[model samples]
Each structure stands twice: as C-alpha cells, then as structure tokens.
Target: MAVFSLMLVVFSLTTGEFVVSGILPDLAAGLGVPLSAAGLLTTAYAAGMIVGGPVVTLLTARVSRKPLIIGLVATSVLANAASAIAPGYAVLLVSRMLAGLVVATFFAVAIATAASTARPGKQASTVGKVVLGLNLGIVLGAPLGTFVGQHLGWRATFWSVAAAAALALLTVLRFVPDRPSATTGPVAGELRVFADRRVQLAIALTAVGNTGVLTVFTYLAPLLTEVGGFPPGAVPVLLLGYGAGAVLGNAVGGRLADRALLPSLAGLLATLVVVLGLAWLGGGHPVATVVSTVLLGALAFAIVPGMQTRVITAAGAAPTLAVAVNASGYQLAAAFAGWLGGQVVDSGAGLRAIYPVAAALTVAGLGIALYSLRRDRRESSAQGSLPGGRSRTS
Candidate 1:
C-alpha cells in the first residue's frame, strides 16, 4: 500500500507536468496566443517547480512527511480543476504554474516518504518505484491527455488529471504512515551538503542532460506536424512510442547503475549524443523521424535513475535535501531548454534546429561526465597509495 501510494503520487506529478505537450495546440487556440508564446506555459510551469522545491522543503522541515505529501497531492487536484475551468489562457497558465509547484513538493516528499519506509538494503528499489511513476507519466499520461483532448476538448484533459490527482490523494492518505519530524537544524546546514565537488558535478550533469532532452521535446509537436509532415492525430502515437522507449531505458539504466555506477552514467550520456544526433539528422524523413523519436526518449531518460543515485551517494548525509535539489535541477534544465528552443524557432531556424542544438548539449554533458570520471580514478589511485598501504593500524 505504501508503494502504491508512492506510485500514485508519481503518476499525478508526471501527468500534471507533461500533459501540456499534447494539449499545446488546443491551449494556443483557446488562449489567443501564438504557439511560441503559448510555449511559455511550459516554461512558466518549470520555473515554478524550480522555485517551489526548495521553499516547500524548507517550510515543511518540521512537518510530518505523510500529511505534507497528501496536502501537496490535493493541491495538484485543485490546480488541475482550476486549469480545466479557466476562462482564458492567463488563468490556465497560472493554474498550471501552481500545479508545477504542487508537483515539486509532491515529488520531493514522495522520495523522502519512500526512503523512510523502505526495508534495509532496498532503498534503491524503493526510489525506483517512485521513479517508475514519473516514467509512467511520461510514457502514459501525455497520450491520455492527447486522446481526451482530441475527442472531448482540451478542458477534458485537465478534468481527467484532476480526477487522477484526487485518486492519488486518497491512496496516499489511506496507506502512507505519518512521518517523523525532519531534522531541526538550520536549513543552511542542510544545504551545505551540496557544496561537495562531486555533488556539484552530479547536479551539473543532471541539469545539462535534462536540458538536452527538453530542448528537443519542447519542439516535438512542431517538428512532427510541420517538419515531418505527420497528421496532427498521429502526435499521440509518436509520443507513445517515445514513452515506451523511455520505460525500457529507465529499467535498463537502473540495473546498469546498480552494477556499475560511473561507467553507466558515461555510457548513457554517450548514447544520448548518438541518439539525439540521429534524431536531428532524421528530422526530414518521416519513417526515420519516428525511429528517432523512440531512440530520443530512450537515450534521454536512461540517465535519470543513475544521475539521481549519483547525487544521493555524493551527498551522503542529507540525502533528502540532495534529492529535492536534484528535482529542482531537472526543472531548471527543462525551463532553459524550452526558452532556448523557443528562441531558435522564433529566430527562423525552424523547429528541427532544436534537435541539433540539443545534440550539442548532450555532447557537452558527456564531456563533463568524462572529466568527473577521470577525477574519480585519480582520487582512487591517490587513496590506494596512502600511508600503511591500506592497513587499519594507526
């Protein structure tokens, strides 16, 4: 039941964060804004996630984790309902931004909640279950929104999201136990964990890697409809294929990370460069575009679990705060990518241009990962040469 609660939170957050892609056109039509302007909705929402994560974490420092999570999930329901009934685009955008705030809090608390409840030695798997919800959201939620919007109008998609959030709220309330109060130290002390060099590197990689993914995804609709010449109705199918690949990549990445940490991280980033480059090159060919989309999803998301574990390991003392910051890093990357993608599109480079730009970012991230890997090896070699040659005697 506790795991189920975590999954529900994951599903709600995933759907709320991503449903925008499927309904972007409808939103533009209803809001009287150009698609480029309407893309601000995603950017605004991600910005909210970036700001809200730390604020919520700090404010709730003395609160029990379970009740706080339930409240956050309930807020998701209300925001979605507000979005569904919004009379104009401004209201809908604000509502979605609030929904983003709710998502940040829910995810941060869910990870904390999962860690608190996990059996010994199963922490990684517990974290994975929560993440599976996020991946499932990417895999399943957008398609659901697109289908509902196509048939019943865009408002119906929000209505369904509201309903799902309500269900998640109930599951969390019924199953997850009340958490103990968090550490009572000043929040600055909590934040000091991020000062570690390796922690900084891990967050940098997470930020850049996610930027690489969203730079392409933020423009996926335009590429499919305008560049690839796909019918509008086929959008969901392509996204679904991408989602399927994401799930596969996530599962495989998790296992690989468990077995070999830094190697897996470097390998995933290298794969992203190849996959993103292929997708960029294939943008003009329809069959090749579809193939690229699936590969794009796989290569991009494959880093999530591994990158997350890397941060937690590096920030050993304050894993909860570290994980929350990582979520913020992901949102920051998405917001930047969306803004950058929009600039490229509005500048006459066209939507396909975003892919090459994204590919370049992936390559840059791989370079950072390589530097961090070398640093790790050098430190290990230095440690091996320490006095007494690994003897325990003082």
Candidate 2:
C-alpha cells in the first residue's frame, strides 16, 4: 500500500512535468506565444529540476521522509493550480518551474523511500513499481491531457494535473509512514558519493542514456507525421503504444536488476542501439516505424531500473544524494537532448537523422556500462584473493 501510494505521487508529479509536451500547441495558442516560446516552458521546468534535486535533497537530508514527501506533494498542488490560473506566459513559466522543483525533490525522496521499504533483495523491483507511475504519465497522462486540451482548453489540462496531484498528496498522507532517515551521514559525507568511480560511471550512463531516448522522443510527433506518413491525429495512439512498451520494460528491467544487474544494463543499452538504428532505417514505413518506436520505448526504459539500482548500491550510505544527483543528470541531459534534436530538425537533417544521433548516444552509454562492469569484475577478483576469501564487490 505504501509503495502504491508513492507510485501515485510520482505518477502525478511526472504527469505534470510531461503533459506539457503533448499540449504545446494549445498552450501556445491560448497564451498568445510562439511555439518556440511555449517550448521554453519545458526548458524552464528542466532547469528547475537540475537546480532543485540537489538543493532540496541536501536541505531535507535530515528530515523524516513522510512529511518531506507530503510537503513536496503540497507544493506540486499549488504549482499546478497556479499554472491553471496563471494570467500570462511569464506566470505560467514560473508555475512550471515550481512544479519542476517539486518533481525533482519528490522523486529523489520517493524512490529512496520505496527502495527502503521493500523486502530484502527486492529494492530494484520496488523502485521499478514507483517508476511505473512516471511511465504511465508519459503513456496515459500526456495523451489524456492532450485530448482534454484539444477538446476543452490548455488550462483544463493543468487543472486536471492539479487534481491528480491533490489525490496523490492525500494518498501519501494516508498511507506513507514517517520513517527514519536513509542515512546518518552529514551533508558533506553524502555529497562524497560523487568521488566513487562506479557512482560517476553510473551517473554518466544515466545522462547519456536519457539523452538518447529524449532526443528521439522530443521529436516523435514530427517523425511520425513526416517520416512515417501518419496523420497528426494518430500521435496519441502511437504514444500509447510507446508507453505500453515502457511499462513492460520497467517491470522486466526491475526483475532483471535484482538478479543480474550488469548484464541487464549492458543488454538494454545494446538493445537501444539496435532499436534506434531500426527506427532510423525503417522510418519511411508506417508499420515498421510504429514497431520500432514501441521497441525503442521498451529498450530505453528497461535501462532505468538497473541504472537506479546500480547507483543506489554504488553510493552505499548516501543513496538519497546519489539518486537526487542522478535525477538532476537526467533533467540536464533531457534539456540538452531537446536542443540537440531541434538543431537536427532546423539544420535540414530531417527527423530520420535524430534516430542515428540517439543511437550514437546509446553507444556511448553502453561503453560506460561495459567499463563499469569490467571494473566490478576486477574488484571482485581482488576481493576473492584476500585472506578472508569474501568478495567485497558482492
């Protein structure tokens, strides 16, 4: 029940973050801004996340988990409500940023809480369940919000998000308990996780992997319409397919992480390379494009659970700060990937080129994962040779 509540909170928070992409057209038209200016709303939110994750996590490092989560959910409610009622583009932008701040803090804490609450050895699986909410937001919330915006108004989408956040806040208040801190270490000690080579590699893997996925995802609508020959109206249905794939991938990845972390991570990254390559090559065929898109979504998300588990385990006592930093890396990479995709489109390279670009990023991530895996093996061998004959890497 507690895990389910946390998932709801994350779902509501992530939905508020991603729903903007699906409704950008309506939002721009309603606010009397150009599409490019409206796109800045996403950029502002990412900026807030990049800044908020560490700051909020560090400030609340000593606080109990339950109240901290509740406070973040409350902030989300106010932010989305402000977004729904904002008088101008500027106000809406600020509201979006506030919403972003809530997401960064909320996810970091919520994920750690979920992992801590799980039965022994099921940390990654529990974290995966919580992350399923984020995937559902992308799968269901964005399209639903888009549908609502198209039929009603852009502001209605924000209102719906506010309502979801309110419901999530209630769930957290009702079900989540005030647990002890995940760490007894001070802020300085928590921040030292960055010094670990494995942690650094895991963070890099997340950033690069996310960049690969978002680069293609940020331009999925155009890719489908122009390259796949799908009408604009069909986008929601296609996004649904992608989201379904993501949900499946999240579940599978979590189970695999619990059993074989490194192999699963490597396999997922390699799968992304193949998926994106196929997406680029087969993009001209509608059926092929749809299949590739769904596969791409699955392979891309399948890497997340293993990555998150790897980071938390690697960080040892400082999982909260480490996870927050990882979240920040994801947001920063997303901001960069969005810009990179725009540049590809603007430079006459066309949407098809974006897939290859994404593939290259995944290849980079795969390289990092392999390096980390090899290092782990060497450390295990060394630990096995020690006097006690116990492997420290294990």
Candidate 3:
C-alpha cells in the first residue's frame, strides 16, 4: 500500500510534466503562441526540474522523509493550480517551472522510501515498481489529461492535474512511511561522492544517454499526426499502446538489471538506437508508426531502473542527493532535447530528422556506458590484486 500510494503520488506529479506533450497544439492555440514556441513549455518544466532537484535536496537534507514528500506534493498542487489560472504564456511558463521544482526531491524521497521497504536483492524490481508510477503518469495520466484537454480546454487539463495531485497528497500522507535517511549530514560531506570518476560518469551517462529518447518523445504528437497522417483523435489510443509498452519494459528492465546491470543497459541502449531509427523510417506509415510508438516507449523506459541503480551505487553514502542530481541532469538533457528537436523541425530536416539525430545521441550514450563498464572492470581487477601482484580472496 505504501509503494502503491507512492506510485499514485508519482502519477500526479509527473502528469504535469508530460501533459503538455499531449495537448501541445491545443495549448499553443489557447495561449496564442506558435506551435514551436509552445514546445518550450516542456523545456520550461524540465528546466525547473534541472534546477530544483539538486538544489532543493541539498537544502532539505535533514528534513524527515514523509513531511518533505507531503510538502513537495502540496507545492505541486499549487503550481498546477497556478498554471490553470495563468493569464498568459509567461505566467503559465513560470507556473510549469514551479510545478517542476518539487519533482526531484519528491522522487528521491519516494525512491528511498520504496527501496527501504524492499526485500534483500530485490532493489531493482522494487525500484522498477516505483518508476512504474512515473510510467503510469506518462502512459495513462498524460493521455487522459490530453483527452480532457481535447474535450474541455487545456486549462482544464491543468485543473484536473491539480485535483489528482491533491488526492495523491492525501494518499501520501496516509501511506508513505517516514523512513528517515541514514546519511543525513552536512552538504560538504555529501559533495565528495561527485569526485569519483565513475560517479561523474554515471551522472553524465544518464543525461547523455537519455537525451535521444526525450527528443523523439518531446515531439511525438506532431510526428504521429503530422508525419504519420494519423488523425488527432487517434493519439490518445496510440498513447495507450505506448503506455502498455512502457509498463512491460519497466518490468523486464528491472529483472534484467537485477541480474546484470551494465550488460542490461548495453542491450537496451543498442535496441533503443535501432528502435529510434525504426521510428524515423516508419514515420510515414500509420501501421509501422504505431508499432514504433509502442517499441519506443518500451526501449526508452527500459533503461531507467538500471541507470538509477548505477548512479545510486556509485554515489554510495549520498544516494538521496545523487538521485536528485541525477534526475536534474536528466531534465537538463531533456531541456536540450526539446530545443534541439525544435531546431530540427524548423531546419527543413523536418520532424523525421529528429529521430536520426536522436539515434546519434543514444549512440553516444551507449559509448559512455561501454566505457563505464570497462572502467568498472579495470578497477575491480586492480582491487582484486594483492600488493605482491597475486589474487586475494578470489
């Protein structure tokens, strides 16, 4: 029940993050902005996450988990409400950013809480379930919010998100146990974990590795309807398929990461590159495009649990702050993706161009993962060696 409530909290908070994707056209029109310009709303929210995660986590390092989470969700409710009532684009943009500010702290706490409850050796699976809330927000909340936006208005979507967040807040208060952090200490102490080359690599790997997926996903609506020739009404249904794929991917990825973390990421990233290319090639065909959509969600999200585990392990004693910083890095990359994708759309390369470029970014991420794996092996080899150049415990 605690984990489930935490998932519900994630659902409400994250719905605000991607709801703009589903209702981009409507929102752009409603706010009297260019479609391209409206894409920045996504960027704005991401930018907030980019700034909020590390900064807020550092500040609240000593706060109890349950209260911190409740406060964060309450902030989300207010931010979404502010978005719903914004008088114009600037106001709405600020509101979105504000809503984003609470995400990383909330997520870090939720993840720690969920992990604390996990049975030994099931960390990845349990983390996957926590991440499932994020998947649910992406797959279910965004589409339903979009459906609501289509029927009522874009503002109505924000209003509805606010209500959902409020309800989740109650569940969080009821169910999320106050699992105190063990490493709660001075900020200066926690900062040293970033000095580890592997830790730095893990954080960069997340930002660089995930950029491609975010790029394609940020522009999915236009790619589906404008390029693939699907009607606007078909989007919500297609998103459901994408959502289904995401859920499956999360489950499978968790199990794989539990068995072998780096190897699993390598496979998933390679598959992601191919799937992204397929999305590009299949852009013009409705059937193929739909297939790519589901595969995209699956491949894109399949890597998350492993990535999270990688950084947390790397950060060691400062896992909470590491998770927050990692999430911020992810949003920083996402903000770049939204900008780069928009540039692709405007550069005469068209929306299809975004996919190929996205594939390239994923390739870079794969390279990073390989390097990190190689380094891990080298360090393990060194540590296992004795002063006399012989094996230790074997």
Candidate 4:
C-alpha cells in the first residue's frame, strides 16, 4: 500500500511534467506563438527543475520524508491549477516553472524513500517500482491527458492533473510513513558527496545519456507528422507504443541493474545508440518509424535504473542530495537538448536530423559508461590485493 501510494505521487508528478509534449501544438495555436516559442515551455520547466532540485534538497534536508512528499504534491496541485487558469503565455510559463520545482524535489525525496524501504540488496528493484510510476504516467496519463486536451482544451489537461495530484496527496498522506533519512548531516556535509569520483561520473553519464532520449522525444510529434507522414491525430497512438516500451524496459533494467550495475549501464547505453541509429535511418517510413519509436523508448529508459542506482550507491551516506543532483543533471541535459532540437528544427535541417543528433549523444554517453566501468574494475582489483601481493580477504 505504501509503495502504491508512492507510485501514485510519482505518477501525478510525471504526468504533469510530460503532458505538455502531446499538447504543444494546441498550446502554440492557443497562445498565437510559433512552435519554437512554445518549445520554450519545455525549456522553462526543465530549467526550473535544474535549479530547484539541489536547492530544494538542501533546504529540506532535515525535513521528514512523508510530510515533504505531501507538501510537494500540494504544491503541484496549486501549480497545475495556476496552469489551468493562466491568462497568457507568460503566466502559463510561470506555472510550469513552479510545477517543475516542486516535481523535482518530490522525485528526489520519493525515490530515496522508496529505496530505503526495500529489503537488503533489492534497492534497485524497489526504486524501479517507483520509477514504474513514471513510465505509467508516460504510458497512461500523458496520452489520456492529450486526448482530453485535444477534445476539450489544453487547459483542461492541467485541471485533470491537478485533480489527480490531489488524490495522490491524500493517498500518500494516509499510507506512506515518515521515513527519516539515514544521513542527518548538515547541508554542507551532504553536498560533499559530489567529491566522489564515481558519483561525479554517474552524474555526467546520466546527463549525457538522458540528453540523447530527450533530444528526439521533445520533437517526436513534429517528426512523426511532418517527416513520417503520419496524421497529427496518430501522435497519441505512437506515444502509447513508445510508453509501453518504456514500461518493459524500466522493469528489465531495474532487475538487471540489481544484479550487475556497471554492465547493465554499459549495455543499456549501447542499446540506445543502436536504437537511435535505427531511428535515424528509418524515420521516414511509417512502419519503420513506429517500430523505431518503440525501440527508442525502451532502449532509452533502460539506462535509467542502472544509472540512478549507481549514483545512490556511489554517494554512500548522502543518497538524498546525490539523487537530487542527479535529477538536476538530467533536467539540465534535457533543457539543453530541448533548446538544441528547437534550433535544429528552426535551421531548416528538418525533423529527420534530430535522430542522428540523438544517436551521437548516446554514443558519447556509452563512452563514459565504458570508462567508468574500467575504472571500477581497476579500483576493485586494487582493493582486493594485499601489501605482499596476497588476497586481502583470504
């Protein structure tokens, strides 16, 4: 019940975050802005997350996890309500930014809480359950919200999110316990976890790797309609396929990561490179494009559990702050990728070019993963050897 409650909180948060993707056209048309300008909504939301994750984590370091979760959900409800009733583009952007801030804090705290609740050695699996909420939001919530937005109005979508969040808040308040953090250190002490080389590498890998996925995902609607020759109405269906793949990938990746973290990370990044490469080549054909979208979603999300587990383990005593920083890294990468994709579209390079760019980013991330893996093995070998060249444990 507790786990389910946490999932609902994450679901509501993620739906609010991603629902904009499906309704960008509606939002643009309603506001009388260009697509590029509407794209700024994504950028603004990510920028708020990038800035808010660490800041909120620092400020709330001493707060109990349960109340903090409740408060964040309440904030989300208000933000979405504001979004639903915003008078103009500027007002809507402000609402998104506020929502982003609360959502980032919610994820960092909620993931930490979920992981801490796990039985020994099953941390990734527990965390993955929470992440499943995120995938489910992508799978069920976003498309449903998109459908509502299309039929009613985009503002109606935010209203739906606000109501969902309100329900999640009640569930969380009732079911989830107040789990105190293991690290009771001051904010400065918690921040010091960034000094670890492994944690640092994990953050970089997360940012670079996630940028690959977001680069393509941020522009998927336009690519499908304009380049793949799909009707605009088909976008939700395609996203549903993509989201289903993400659900499978998230489950598999979490279990695999629990068994072999580094190998799982490297393998998933390699898969992303291949999937995006295929997407780049096959995006112009209808069937191929749909298949590639599903594959891309799966391969891209498969890296998340491993990467997140790596950061939590590497950070040792300061997992909360570490996870918050990692979330910030993802949003920073997403913000940059969103902006870059917009520029690519505006440059008249066409929608097909975005997939190749995404592939390149994944390749870069794969290189980092390999480098981190090698470093880990070398360190492990060094720790195992004794002063006289004997096995330390034996």
Candidate 5:
C-alpha cells in the first residue's frame, strides 16, 4: 500500500513538473505571454525544489513520515488547482512555485517511507519502487499531459494533475504507516552527509549524470522536429519510447546493483556516454536519432536507483539526509544543464549542439564513477585487514 501510494504521488509530481513543457506553446499563447516567460513554470518549480527539499526535510525531520507525505500531497493538489484557475500569468507562476515546494517535501518523505517500510536488505528494492514513480512520471506524465493539452487546452493539464495528486493524497492517508519521531539534533545533522567521501561521490555522480541527460532532454522536442525532420505529431511517440526505455533500464539496474554496485554504475554511465554521443551526431537520420534517444533515457535512468542505493549505503545511519540531499543534487543538475544548454542555443549553435555537450558531461561522469569504484575497493581491502574480519564498512 505504501508503494502504491508512492507510485501515485510520483506520477503526480513528475507530471506536474514537466507537463508545462509539453504545452508551452499553447500555454504561452493562451496567457498572452512570451514562450520564454512561460518557461518560468518549469524554472519556478526547479527553484522551489532547490529551496524546499532541505528546508522541508529539516523542518519536518521530527514529524511523522506518513503525515508529512499526506500533507504534501494535499498541498500539491491545491497548488495544481490554483495553477489551473490562475487569473493571470503571475498567479500561475506562484502556483507552480508552491507546487514545486510541495514536490520537494514529497521527495524526502517518499524515500524515507520506502526505505523504512522494508527490512534491512530490502531497502534498495523498496526505495527503487518509490523512485520508479519519478521515472514513470518523467517518461509518461509529461508527454501524456502534453497530449491531453493538445485537445483539452492547457488548463485541462493542471486539472488532470490535480486529480492525480488528490488520488495520491487519499492513497497515502489510507496506506502508508506512521514512522517514529526523528532524533533531535541541530539542523547540521541533516547536512552532515556532505562530510563523507563516498556519500559526496554519489551526490556528485548523480549531479553529473543528471546534467548530461537534461542538457539533451531539455531540448528534445526541438531537436526531433527541427533537426531530425520528424513530424510534429511524432514528438510524443519518441518521448514515450524514451520513457519506456527508462522503465526497462531502471528494473535491470536494480537487479544488477543488488549483485555488484560499482559494476552496475560503471556500465550504465559508460553506456550513456556512447549513446548520447551517437545521438549528438546521429540527428540527420530519424530512426538512429530515436534509437539513441531511447538508449539515452534508459541508460540515464539506469543510474538513478543504483546511485541512490550507493548513497544510502555510504551514509549508513544517516540515509534519510543522504537520500534527500541526492534529490536536491538531481534537481540542481537539471537546472544547471537547462541553463547551460540555453546558452548554447542562444548562441545559434542549434539543438544538435545540446547532445554533444550532454555526451561530454556524461563522459566526465564516467570518470567520477571510476574513482568511486576504486575507493570502494580500497575500503573493502581495509576492512579485510581488520583482525576479526567482520567487515566494518557499510
């Protein structure tokens, strides 16, 4: 039931975050705003995630996880409703910002619920299910909302998202179990994961991986339409294919991580670099571009669950803060990638340039993955040297 509730929340949050992109043109026209101004719907959401994740995580650290999730979902539903009925563009922006903050809170609560809901070794699998919601949303929600917007208008998109959020709120209220109170500590305790080397590596890797993908995904529609010469209507199909691939990759990634963490992480990162680079240079051929795009989506998502597992394991007892921080890093990376890619587009480099930059960042991430593996090996070797040989490392 917790998993079911989380899946719904993930679907709603993911849809609400990226749905604006699909209907950007229509939204701009209906609101009588510039396309760039409408883009703030995404930017405001991203900005709110950056601020809300830590703030909410800390402020609600002492609160029960079940109640936190329920409240966040309810807040998200109201915000989406507000967005749907906003009297003007400015009010819509405010609505999105509110929604974004709630989404951030959801991220922390959802992961904690997923992790604690399970027994010790089952942590990764449980949390993976929760994170899977985000992947499903990224893969399904945005495009689905976009398609709905085409016929029903942009306001319908928010209405649908609000409905989803409301459903999630009810599910969480009915299903998720209440957690014990969090330990009382200064707020610094939540931020302490930053001091751990392996934890920092995991966060850095997540940021790098996210930056690589967003740099390309942020401009996907334009690339497919303008560069690949794909029909306008075909964009959603391509996006759906990408989402499907991410779902596949995420499942496979979890299995591999359970056996050997570093090997899984390295393979996914390496595959992403190759696939994204090919996507950069493959734009002239429509089939090849779509294949590479799906591969890019799959490979990037493949890293998410495994990397999250690595963060939790590395942080030991502080897994909650570690997971929350990882969520923040992921959003931060997307914002950075989108901004940097915008610079490339503004300079007349065209959408094709975005993937090549993405490819480069992915390659850099592969390097980070390698360093993390070597560190893991060293830590293992050190544990072997202990007299009792009980394996003190997490």
Candidate 6:
C-alpha cells in the first residue's frame, strides 16, 4: 500500500513533466509565446530535478521520511495548480520547474522507504515496483494528459495532473509510514560518500549505462518514421510497446538484482549492447524494427534497478545522499543524450546511425560494470583474509 502510494506520486510527477510536449502548440498559442519558447518548459523541469533534488535532499536529510514526502508532493500539487492558472509564460515556466524540484528527492526517499519494508533480499523487487510508476506515466498518464489537453485546453491538462498529484499526496499521507534514519550521524557526513572511489564508480556506471539507451529513445520518432518506414501515426503505438516493455523489464530486473547485483548488471549491459546493434542493423525491416524496439526498452530498463542497487550498496549507510546524486547523474546523462543524438544527426550520419553509436557507448558502460565487479571481488577476497572477514565500504 505504501509503495503503491509512492508510485502514484511518481506517476503524477512524471505526467506533469511529459505532458508539456503534447500541449506545446496549444500552450504556445494560449500564452502568446513562440513554440520554441514553450518547449523550454521541459528543460526547466529537468533543470529543477537535476539541481534541486540533491541539494534539497541533503538539506532535509534529518527530517523523517513520511512528512518529507508529503511536503514535497504537496508542493508539487500546488505548483501544478499554479501552472494551470498561470497567466503568462514566465509563470508557467517557473511553475513547471517547481513541480520538477521534488522529483529526485521524492524518488530517493521513496525508494529507500519502500526498500526498508522489503523482506531481506527482496529490496530490488520492491524498488522495481516503485519504478513501475515511472514507466506507467510514460505509458498511460502522458497520453491521457495529451488527450485532455487536445479536447479541453492546455491548462486543463495541468489541472488534471494537479488533481492526480493531490490524490497521490492524500494516499501517501495515509499509507506511507515514518522511517527512522538508518544512520543518524551528522548529515554532512553523507556527502563524503561521494568522494569514495566505489561510490563514484557506481554513480558513473549509472549515468553511462543509461545514456546510450536514452539517446536512442530520444530520437525514436525519427528512427521509426524515416528508417523503419513506419508512418508518423505509428510512433505513439510503438512507444507504448516500448513503455510496456519497460514495465516488464523493471519487474524482471529487480528480481535479478536481488539475486546478484553486479553480475546481473554486467549481463544486462552486454545484452543491451547487442539489442542496440540489432536495432541498428534491422531498422529498415518493419517486423525487425518492432521486435528490436521492444527488446531495447526491456534490456535498457532491466539495467536500472541493478544500477540503483549498486549505488545503495556502495553507499553503505549513506544511501540517501548518494541516491539523490545518482538520480541527478541520470538526469545529466539524459540531457547529454539529447545533445549527443543531435550531434550524430547533424553530422550527416543518417538517423539509422543512432543505434550502432548508442551501442558502442553501451559497450563502455559494460566495461565499467565488469571492472567494478572485479574490484568488488578483490575487496571480498581481501576481507576473507582478515581475522573476522570484515567487509570494506570505501
């Protein structure tokens, strides 16, 4: 129940973030702003999440979890409401950023809260369920918001998300329980984990591992229309398939992570490289493109839970700050993906070139994962040589 409530928060948050693209034309006309200016709303939200989540999380680390999430989600609800009623582009843009500010912090706390309730080894499975909300937002919430915007108005879409956020806040207040801090030392101490070589590597792995797949996804529409020979109309449907695969991958990935974190990540990254290559090679074939698209989504998301688990494991008792930073790293990688994809396209490489290029990047991530695993083994073997086989964190 608690985990589901958290999922609702993510669903609402992400819905608000993604629906901007759907309502871009309406929003531009409504606010008398250019469409390009309206598109900045998405960048604003990403900026808020990337910059605000970690700083806010660090500042509020001593607070109890339940009220903290409630506060953040409630703030998001109000921000969305503000967006719904905003009279100008500046107001709308700031409101979107406000709504985005809570995303990373909320996710970090929420994942930890959910994992705390999991039975022993099932932590990753629980985290996976929480992550399912994100994929669902891409699958259901964005489309629904877009429809509402088209039929009603762009402002109506914001209202819809505000309502969803309010509902999430209420349920979370009811279902989510307060958790005592796992480590009660000075909150600033958590910041030191960032300096640890293992922690840094884990965060880097997450950023690198996600970049390739996301770059492919960023250009998916063009890839489908130009390369796969699918009509523009089919793009949304294929995205739905991709989103569905993400949901399934989350389920399977979490279970695999719980069983073996590093090995599973290594295997998943290797597979993702292969799938991206397949996507590149078979993109012109309709059936092959469809199959490869779904597989890409699955393989890509299957790596997430394990990467997150790796961060938490490496952080030891200071996972919250580490997790927040890790999420920021992911957002940064996403920002980079768009730029990288744009660069590839502008270089006169055909749109089909995205897959192999992305695949090569995933290969780098795979190398990092294996290297991390090797270091883990070395540390474990060294621990076994000690008097009581004590584990090492740094």
On lDDT, the leading prediction is 6
- Candidate 3: misplaced stretches above 4 Å? 21-41, 85-93, 150-155, 225-232, 281-286, 387-394
- What is candidate 3's CA lDDT for residue 328? 89
lDDT of 4 at 332: 80
Q: Assess the local accuracy of residue 380 in candidate 2 as a C-alpha lDDT between 0 and 100.
A: 82
Query: Which of the predicted structures, 3 or 4, would earn the higher TM-score when compared with the native?
Result: 4
Q: Give per-residue lDDT, candidate 6, residue 74.
A: 88
Kindly report the root-mean-square deviation of model 2 from the true structure over all alpha carbons.
2.0
TM-scores across all candidates?
0.86, 0.95, 0.89, 0.90, 0.92, 0.97
What's the CA RMSD of model 3 in angstroms?
Answer: 3.1
lDDT of each: 0.79, 0.87, 0.87, 0.86, 0.82, 0.89
Worst window of 10 by summed lDDT in candidate 5: 179-188
Q: Over the stretch 1-394, how does candidate 1's per-residue lDDT look in tens digits?
A: 8878788778877887787877889889877899988788877778778878777777776677777787788888898899899998789889988988756666766776776677764555566677888888877876787789988998999999899888878887788888775657776687788779999998898888678788888788788888888999998789888888887777777677767777888988888877777777777799998998888777666777778777777777666666777899887787788789989989998887887788788888888788888998887777778885563333
In the range 250-277, model 5's lDDT, one tens digit per residue, is 7778777776787888888888877877
Highest-scoring model, TM-score? 6
Tell me the tens digit of each residue's lDDT in model 2 across 1-394. Answer: 8889988888887888888987998889989999999999988888888989998888888888888888888988999999999999999999999888867778878888888888888988899999999898888787788788889899999999999989988888889978876556676677777999889998998998779888988888899999999999998789889888999999999998888898889988898899888888899998899899889778778888889888888988888788888999998898798889999888998778999999998899999989999999998889889878876554
lDDT preference between candidates 2 and 6, better one: 6
Query: Per-residue lDDT of 117-225 in model 3, one digit per residue for the tens?
Result: 8887777778889899899898779878989999999999999999999998888888878867535567778788889898899999899999999998878888889
Off-target runs (Cα >4 Å) in candidate 5 are 119-121, 346-350, 390-394
The TM-score, computed over Cα atoms with residue i paired to residue i, of candidate 6 is 0.97
**CA displacement after TM-score superposition, residue 373 of candidate 1 (Å):** 2.5
Candidate 4 on 117-228: residue-level lDDT in tens? 8888788878888889999998898878999999999999999999999998888878898987545766678877898999999999899978978998878889889888
What is the lDDT ranking, best to worst? 6, 3, 2, 4, 5, 1
Q: How does residue 165 of candidate 1 score in lDDT?
A: 83
